[model samples]
Target: MQRRTWVPIATGIVALVFFALPSEEPLRGFLPDWVSLVLIYWTFALPARMMVGMAWSVGLVVDIVSFGLPGAYALSKAVLVYLARVLALRVRTYPLWQQTIVVLGLLGIEALILTLIDFIVSGDLSGLQRWTAVVVGALVWPVVYWILRRARHLARLGH
Candidate 1:
């Protein structure tokens, strides 16, 4: 992979580690979904390179780490990336709030898809708690974007 590719991959790995860390509180549930935010950002910014299969693979790793229903996140991430790609042009033109709204919507759909899969596989509804994490991720989107943009800017300067 090129040097530019490593940044997003490394970011994804760090996100996976953060999400995989054990936690006792209810808020800990949201960590796994952070990868969706990272993926969306990169998908929009680098659509030529960040393909759906890559998203699916990253999602699979998250699934393995979280020990959730297998393939749940993999499928969701694939869909998220697909939507991001389809909407990339329009999304890039929108203001930050509009972009965040779109991301929030995508995150919600991802959560719903994962919940449906978990329900079908486990026949249990306990995964609803994970929605809180999605909500938190949505609320934090602007800050996440700002940080990511700054990092990208710094990386450009370094190069």
Candidate 2:
């Protein structure tokens, strides 16, 4: 496969690995939403290559890996892709710091969708603490964006 094909796959796998790693109760919430961050970065950086269907598939993998509600993550990720696609052009122009705000909003929406699904399926809202990851993800957006952007340049994935 070409670099375009394998690079995203490799990055996605890394995100999933980070997402799947075990953590202590106190530290778990601090782990950024690596999967969502990657999806957003790719969506912004390569709008034509990253589609809603692809996001859904990645979310499904996340769902399976996390052992959550079957379609919860999938549905949320699909929605995230749709929203990201709609805002891709605009978001891409912003400086990385400003883009961090947008990323926070996007990740928050994903969290909302997951929270709603959890409520509907299990009647438990869990805790507000779960949102810590959203904040962490926003703060980590620059790093994620920089890393992926560097990778893209390294691979010579020209727009």
* All candidates: TM-score: 0.88, 0.95
> How do the residues 16-96 of candidate 2 rate in per-residue lDDT, one tens digit apiece?
999999999889778887999999988888888888999999999999999888899999999999999899999888988
Model 1 pairs in collision: none
> What clash count does candidate 1 reach?
0
Per-residue lDDT of candidate 1, residues 1-159 (tens digit): 224546666778877877777788755665546688889888777777778898899888888988876788889999999999998877888999899889888988998887788788878778656777777888888988887777666555232
Off by over 4 Å in 2: 1-3
Best by lDDT: 2
Best by TM-score: 2
Report the lDDT of model 2 for residue 85: 89
TM-score of 1: 0.88
TM-score of model 2 (CA atoms): 0.95
